[model samples]
Target: MNDRLLALKLFSRAGRVGNFSSAGRELGLSQPSASRLIAALEADVGAALFSRTTRAVTLTDAGATYLMRVEAILAALDEADHEARGTGELRGVVRVGTPISFALREIIPRLPAFMKQHPALKIELRVTDRYPDLVTEGIDVSIQFGALPDSSATARKLIRQPRILTASPDYLRERGTPAMPSDLAHHVVIISPAHPSPTFSFRKDGRVVSVRVDGQLAITINEGAIASAVVGLGIAASSESSARAELEAGELVRVLPDWDVGSMEVTAVFVSGKTIKPAARAFTDFLATELRN
Candidate 1:
């Protein structure tokens, strides 16, 4: 049965490529072997599946319909095989959606170790900053930052990422560091328009201060803001996770060490229904453990 299915799949590929030799090459079969298998299939089906031509092989009308049905059958068989495999063994693909910066700076570096541990599992990372529609986009799991809005998906808090007020050391040396939150108004501030307001809020010792800072450079994305700050564009606020490497290397320094720009919640969001794949759940669990540590 499996051999027959494999032959049907090869036949479908031949129909798509419109060449037996090319399709046979893809399936690790020689032209004569592929021709024999396809001939046997046609005999079994009682129909000519393809019309031979000097230039190309075209699927007959019956063959086109058969190709569609065979494709579905193969897909079903693949899914069934995946499901029959042990869930705890961690197989199949996990499609993860994450912020661009986090994916690049954090997750990507650690991915190799995780892949090593679960050699059977495949990972498909979809990096984006925008809030994705999980169901519509067919995402297995999403790493979301900040306060999650009302959603149907289950949310698990992975980490709390503090927003750090940062500036390149060169920029600070040139412009002079602000001693207080109010003094930031006098500096060239790189604002993220994604924030509800241009004002930055800080609280310490029962004191609350809000400074409305502006500058020539206003970046729309967090990663862009971090890059601009790294290049000494101006002072910008970024998540600690995004700026950790630069800060550790002394390329960037915190503008106000005592002040707080508040923290954002990094959550792992999974689909709402019962159909969540084991690979997706395992990957999310792995990420939560790795990221928190």
Candidate 2:
């Protein structure tokens, strides 16, 4: 490989892994070699790319901006290479950010099929509820829900997942079924900390009714809330996709089948202006198709 291309590739890996040593390992180079390459690249670029510390290495602001452009250039080059070879094979790392609950309940289960389809692809799935910093983290793509915050990244709506109020049969039997939205005030509710308000809005009879629910437990994660609901802890408001298996298996039952708690919009987010990698594009397209169906 040419010195410039090699340096850029090393920089990309180092930015993604946040460690020169690990990046070097991935590129089959020693730590010292990786350091030297990155230093040479920085000298050429006339900027420090990383902030070094004892515990971790972090991308400098300039480095983050540069990485975005570098990624786009590399992606274009890869596409050219594929065209020249007359093959559309995808090969590279696709780092994806997604919510933990969604990954466990939806994506992870379907990942094996995707992996089989792209044998040359390396997937690094990072599960978290927090909004990911795409450039700094080197995340190729992210799956986000609900209202998207103002960002420079591009977002495309993938699916509108219906939200449902659910509770275990045992819990309903013990606590008594709630007949109206107002009755929820008397029942135990499992709330997501992400939604701090005690009130839940449901549409019924062409009107939206807001109900204030009380619960002894508040979960920070959707999986925790769903698990609590399944074990008869309290009623949980969750996306239909996440609770599909549990509901189908009779582990959890719908709380009010007639009312709607609004739908969660699932979006695929990617860095703006950066060329989307083939692996990322393929996986995202697969997700969109599968989820919409």
Candidate 3:
């Protein structure tokens, strides 16, 4: 067999089944033959892919990493084959994952336009506060927020969202606004998406002052904390971009304007290097262009 195709089938099977014997069965080969093919492929690539045992077969970190790209190559090859065979249009399901706030505020509303443009395509949008593993969930694209720790998947910045500290107009009216970072101590800070330990920074006369703000309430990300703050519960912080509409609509007010608390990068990521689905690439490009404008 051509090594690339052999490797592709093997990798795909292994990834899909998460087991060697089942992968071999899918390929119509004995387990030993499948093992030999995988070994040969690994030798050619100079990587140890799966950690094997008598009882189970599991992807090594390297294997987990490589599986994404291998899938992409196979997808590209299939798409090319389909186009050559006179498939009239790009038609396939594209699975997209996004955070709850962004999904509600931006992506969902614009999704109809994309669907109209590519009528043949089926779109599955998953919106949740929890981050899902792209591969495990079979996600094609993900609109993610903040800087993620190191990972093999590729990420492209879609926009910059500044973190802003804000409070309800009612809260500000009663407790008084903090003119400086240090003054936050006197206010009831609403900490959401509770940090392991909370620390925040702001500016005072152009110098940065760091403060460890504590609160009576601790909630998880994109929950009712902001709502709580808006209802005069306390001061809260979140991505300014996320809170922009609310702030403009007078639901919340930006506090400590002089502070230079930097923003985080919001990115659109796809498991492309390993499994570059055309729909994923197309959607990612569309989002990047749309957000840029």
lDDT of each: 0.81, 0.86, 0.75
lDDT of 2 by residue, 22-55 (tens): 8888778899999999999999999999999999
Candidate 3 C-alpha lDDT tens digits along 77-183: 86795477575355767889987777777787788878887788888888876667776566777887766644766887788877777788989999998988888
Query: Which stretches of candidate 2 lie above 4 Å from their native place?
Result: 1-3, 12-30, 43-69, 193-196
Per-residue lDDT, model 2, residue 260, is: 82
Model 1 TM-score? 0.70
lDDT of 1 by residue, 1-293 (tens): 46687688689778777888887886788999889989999999999999998888899999988987886676566567666774546665678999888899989999998898789887888888888877545577899888676577788888897888899989998999999999988888887623435788898888999988876787767789888999999887778878888899998999898887788788888766425566676777888899879
Which one is best on lDDT?
A: 2
Deviation of model 2 at 209, angstroms: 1.2
TM-score of each: 0.70, 0.86, 0.74
How much lDDT does candidate 1 score? 0.81
What TM-score does candidate 3 reach?
A: 0.74
> How many steric overlaps does candidate 1 have?
0
Pairs of residues at least 3 apart in sequence or in different chains that clash in candidate 2: none
lDDT score, candidate 1, position 72 = 64
Query: Among these predicted structures, which one has the highest TM-score?
Result: 2
